[model samples]
Target: MSLDEVRDEARAFLSDHFPKWRKENNARGDLDFEQQRSWQRYLYEHGWGVPTWPIAYGGRGLGMLESMVWNAEKVSAGAHTFFNLVGLGLAGPTIIARGSDDQKARYLPALARGDEVWCQLFSEPSAGSDLGNITTRAERIDGGWVVNGQKVWSSGAAESDRGMLVARYDTSLPKQQGLVYLLADMHAPGVDVRPLRQIDGGAHFSEVFFTDVQIADDDLVGGPGDGWSVAMTTLTNERMSLGGGFGTFAMSFDEVVDIARRTGRIDRYGLVDIYARRTILDVLNNRVQSKLFAGQIPEAEGSVIKLLMAELGTLTADVAIDALGAGGMLAAEAPSAQQRFLGSHAMHIGGGTDEIQRNAIAERVLGLPREPRPDKEVPFKDQLRS
Candidate 1:
């Protein structure tokens, strides 16, 4: 369908369904768990959920442009998208790109329909940006694999049904080559999830522990030793999603302008600086989106955009906080200027650190020589011993 047609249809559907759902749940704020599931199911049944996914996977098989139109309409109608963000944005896309047919059949349908929530079990205490340094081990077992290790900084792990995990499977190989990616059941016998309280007092991030947790061979996402490549796909999608403004508390330029006006700081030079940066951010985001629409993966571009986004978020929040004077110290609810300032800190840390992104941009985009690593050719087991 044409963009106009897609927009009209999306607006009409949201108009008819969203208000009813809101009224029924009396949801003046965010939806509860059950309400989120119900809303997802409602959208899936009507062919709006995961609209960019293939029809066999519970979507309308729409293109990126159409999906953007649908989402724009949702924003206009004050309707939220699917609550299972990791499932739809990160895990689902990775599985489609590298998973076996059986894996796709088993996981994608429920994920797209929001019957299951998913999380990424990639980061660990010792390895956040350096993912290949993770020490989570997966050993070959009788009927499957037995996992024993810990994952930290997993968002929504406490509520996830499954997780996309990367573990060390062959210590004799190089660190990046010895890994395996798998789908882990969060409800498995030895799996534990502990929510980590944030500065905002929200437990959106969690620590996941796997102690002799058994995963069937069928849950393997790709061939053994292909974990690094599979993980790259997931991480690339993650960076793109975050850079696209999926999981951020970023304020628009207009919102910043309004805050400045409200606090009598409209004439501040910071406003001009923020306006210039916001314009640059919009251009970068548009370039990334255009690449995606053209069926290209913007790996280095993703890093650049993510880096810019993090900087922009922090700058915007800082300006707002300064504008608010002492009022910023008095905490309001979330998305308030004060809360946003605090939350913006996470943007620099999540997806990938700003330093990591800068390194990626330097190496991948600017064609710079990589930083020398003594462990580059070392075996994983030897590196661990060192």
Candidate 2:
């Protein structure tokens, strides 16, 4: 079958099966681990999952166009793609690009099959936007290295079995030069995870502490002092994944049109706002969509899509509230409009804050001057922090 045919088939299968598959409890809290494993196994058996990965890496050896179509169909079907979201979305691509042969053999299959859950361990208490300024120290030890420090705002770390961590190793080297990326054991004796409840009331992210955590040589993803470059690989993948079709939920502006027509709000001032939204939507479907087909290499512009989606999310939730008036918040037992309101805030904050993304686009994509940072050259130990 052609790629379109394959996508239609997947959509039809999902349309018939998704509702029954998504039991109420399954949607209550990020699909349970058992359900995730089962769902991944189903995808694996069906020649899906890891579509763009090499055949040798346990992927379907499918081309990017086919993979993109599959992702669009999957989202349209409302199929839960949360299983190994971070693992496959960010970590897997990084490993494929920069990891050693052994690393690929050990991690890629597990990541593809959902056997291993991965979290990003890049942000720190004092190093959110300025991640290169992280104070998490990894001292060289006899056999390998010993890590000591903390990482915060890590998504899914509480349930993650492993993490892709970036840390500073040698004080003598330049700040960006002495950094390294490694696979950290989440269950190691020195690793501690504490959930951070957000304004939305979900404990989806966590702060992780590593004290005297010993990492063997094999655990290091790239060579010592190459963390920045290795991190760029992951960062680029993260942006690509963000801009990738699957990353954007299929909640299009057409739905807003439907809601406005239903509520007779199409003639109001709010309708102008909706029109602006439709304009943004058109740019996405026309400009960005065509750019992808033209084979333009991706960049932090992926974050532009993410930022647009976040804005749309907020607008959508607000429109729902204004349309339903007093009744919007009443559906407590079912999936209510309030849930969307609660959830939209995270879209801007998670996956690198909107501010950080703008900075990246300005510096990397537009060739704007780099942001001033006096601490860029300072050693982790020498830097003073509150």
Candidate 3:
């Protein structure tokens, strides 16, 4: 179908369906968990939930442009996409790229239909930026693997049904080697999730602990020792998703202008600066999407987008808070300038830290030399001992 047709269909569907669902569910602002699930199921039944995915996987098999149009129309209609973004943005793509046919058949339909939610179990207390330093271990056992470790800052983990987990399977090998990627059952016997409350008073992030958690051998996403490569794909997509302006704290140039005008800070915060930054972000996103549609990975470009997005989010929040002046100190029941300012800090830390993105850009994009690592060849066990 043409892009315009897709947009029209999306607008009509939302106009017809969303209000009824909202009214029936009594959803005023942000949706509750059950409301999000019901809404996603409603979209999926109508073939609009994941239109970019293949038809066999429960989508309409639409191309990138059509998917973008549908998303724009949904936003214009004041509808939210599926709340399980990790499932849609990270896990689903990684599975499509690296999963076996059986894996895809078993997982994709439920994921696309929003019957199951997924989360990332990559970072740990010690491995936030330097992911290669993770101490999580997945020991080989009869009929499956046994995991014993903890993951921190896992978004939506408390609500997830599954998680993409990277763990050390053979610690005798180097830090980046002898690892394995597995699909973990979040409701397994030994798995525990503890939500971490943020400064914005939201418990959107969590700490996930595993103690002798059993994962079937069939849950492996790739061959043994391929964890690093497989995880790189997920991380790259994560950077792109975060940088594509899907963030909770994203503010458009028009919104900033309106806020400035309302607060009489139109002259204090330069509208020109906000407009320029927003334009740059849009151009960067377009370039990245074009490259992706052309079947290119654009890994380095993802880093650039992530870095710029982090900076822009912080800058926008700063402007909003400054414009609000003393009024920012007062808390509102809904998300306000103060909440956005507090939440913007998470963008810098999640999807890899700003410093990590800068280093990646410097080395991979600019052809600069990599930083020295004396322990590059050290075994994982030995590194832990030190």
Best by lDDT: 1
Q: Ranking under lDDT, best-scoring first?
A: 1, 3, 2
Q: What ranges in model 2 sit over 4 Å off?
A: 1-33, 247-295, 327-335, 364-367, 378-384
TM-score for candidate 2, residues paired by index: 0.85
Candidate 1 structure quality by residue, lDDT tens digits, 1-386: 99899988888889999998789877768778888888888788888878878887887888766776777688778786548889999999899889999999999989977899999999999888788898999999876799999999999999999999999989999889999999999999999999999986689999999999999999998899999999999987777666553423477677778877787866568878877877787777777778888888788888877777788888888888887777778776225677678788898999888899889889988999999988868998888532
Q: Please give me the total number of clashing residue pairs in predicted model 3.
A: 0
TM-scores for every predicted model: 0.94, 0.85, 0.93
Off by over 4 Å in 3: 23-26, 243-248, 333-335, 384-386
Total clashes in model 1, counting residue pairs 3 or more apart in sequence or in different chains: 0
Give per-residue CA lDDT, model 3, range 146-262, as digits (tens): 999999999999999999999989988988997899999999899999999889889989999999999998999889899999999898667665654343346766676777788
Give the range where candidate 3 is weakest over 10 consecutive residues by summed lDDT.
240-249
Compared with the true structure, model 1 gives a TM-score of 0.94
> Relative to the unseen true structure, what is the Cα RMSD of model 3?
2.2
Better of 1 and 2 by TM-score: 1
